[model samples]
Target: MDELITVRFFGMVAEKLGKQELVLENPGNSDRLLEHLNENYPDLKEIKFSLAVNKKLCTEPSIIPIGAEVAILPPFSGG
Candidate 1:
């Protein structure tokens, strides 16, 4: 059996990808996952976004546990 990662896109990120969620093979870490996504979805590189692993914000390269839920979040604005 192969491990999988669940990715959820929010706001503009989802608009760019044309979907809100996806399941993919585990990419080992956050950096690898972002690389893979950028390679496959060039539009992603056009906008700034953040990564959250298992609902926690990941500011740097972090291990992605198998079956983890990752979210691609667009910049947020609050007043």
Candidate 2:
């Protein structure tokens, strides 16, 4: 069965995706999710950001759990 993950984007990520959040269907794998994202938004390949699952930063995209909340955080700037 396919699972749906909620992806939340922040800062530039949100701007690039044109939405604050997105619902994606996956098979409970981070790599698969990345593939979906890369396939859907080829432009995202040029941008750098971090993918967090359930508020925790993850290095391997396959760490995301099914039906978990994913957050995309871009580089932050402060003065």
Q: Relative to the true structure, how large is the alpha-carbon lDDT of every model?
A: 0.94, 0.80
Cα lDDT tens digits, model 2, 1-79, are 2378798989887888788988877547667777888898886898899888889888875566778998878898877
Which stretches of candidate 2 lie above 4 Å from their native place? none
lDDT of 1 at 31: 93
Model 2 residue 24 lDDT score: 73
Model 1, range 1-79, lDDT digits (tens) per residue?
A: 2499999999988998999999999999999999999999999999999899999999889999999999999996866
Whole-model alpha-carbon lDDT for candidate 1: 0.94
Regions of model 1 farther than 4 Å from truth: none
lDDT score at residue 62, model 2, on the 0-100 scale = 54
Error of 1 at 18 (Å): 0.2
TM-score of every candidate relative to the true structure: 0.92, 0.84
Per-residue error (Å), model 1, residue 67:
0.4
Clashing pairs in 1: none
